[model samples]
Target: MNKRKYEMTSRADAAARTADRIIDAMLARFATTPYENVRIEDVAADAGVTGQTLIRRFGSKAALMNATVARELARVAAAREEAAQASPTDTIHELIHHYERYGALILKTYSEAPLVAGLPALAARGRAFHVDWCRRAFPLDPSLSPTEKAVRTAQIIAICDATTWRILRFDGELDEAQTEQALAALLLPLLV
Candidate 1:
């Protein structure tokens, strides 16, 4: 007697689910561990798969990281897009919320950037996203000269940076509300 074969669609779905698990496992490890320190076998174990399975799914470590970055960037872009439609104060709160969730991981990646190839480019992409978001969220003074506008934009970028969030939330030990308030105090003034 011949055994029944699995459905192609079902197999595709199972593959997708496995990929999701691998990405989730990678992120979980990345939350606490540096990029260079993350091991294929460890991540595979976390995802309940073998290292070979991981390679079969993602091809390589860099490829896996690229996939992870794509997923994360999409998530962040969606959140920011929704927040952009809200008031500036609400936008700050949203940014604060984002930073609270992902700030540590962001810092970790930045700190480990030089050790990894393509990290600096990844960081630049992140910075470009932030700059674009800031420009949209806080438009510059139209009356200012081009140089002044550039300076103002830089100021906005600096204020909304993850490092600023680290200072207020982690170092200063501000609660979310207080963090929002502090950020607004500094940023809201520029909006006017």
Candidate 2:
């Protein structure tokens, strides 16, 4: 790569690492405390950065939360891709397993806090990516049309997005395995 390109890539990598640290710290906090109780200063302290530094890097608390949500979704997408390559038919299982691992904080933050209420655009984009992921990850049945596949992908994603997980886990009192079983039930028809 060219010098300027290399420089930009390195800077981007550094920024991503910093953001990852912040997200990890935030997740640790969210696991024990409610999102409303956690402040930006607390997040900064947990991440080993100054509040000002976090503001400079992530702008506002909303922005930081959005960035963290986006990062987790990206990680999910990456994991899904890797798992899909190995077991296309079982990619939903991999996705559910991944969710069981890193999805708690995401489900809590977006659901309980108003900080992420302003992230509709980001959420929409994430949904679009999810539809594509579902289409690719799930093995296509010979009986399904392309249009049917597209619609089913969108529907499944709409029902099982981050928000859904929060609702199911909190409101419905469904544990991780229950959530996975429900999703697998909905997804199995598509795979067949």
**Whole-model lDDT per candidate:** 0.86, 0.71
lDDT of 1 by residue, 71-135 (tens): 88778888988998899988998999999888888887778767766667877788789899999
Worst 10 residues of 1 by lDDT: 1-10
lDDT of 1 at 179: 87
After superposition, the stretches of candidate 1 with alpha carbons farther than 4 Å from their true spots are: 1-6
Model 2, C-alpha of 148: deviation from truth (Å): 6.2
Q: Which residue runs does candidate 2 get wrong by more than 4 Å?
A: 1-19, 109-114, 142-186
Candidate 2 residue-wise lDDT at 136: 65
Look at candidate 2 and give me any clashing residue pairs: none
TM-score versus the correct structure, for each prediction:
0.91, 0.66
Clash pairs (backbone) in predicted model 1: none
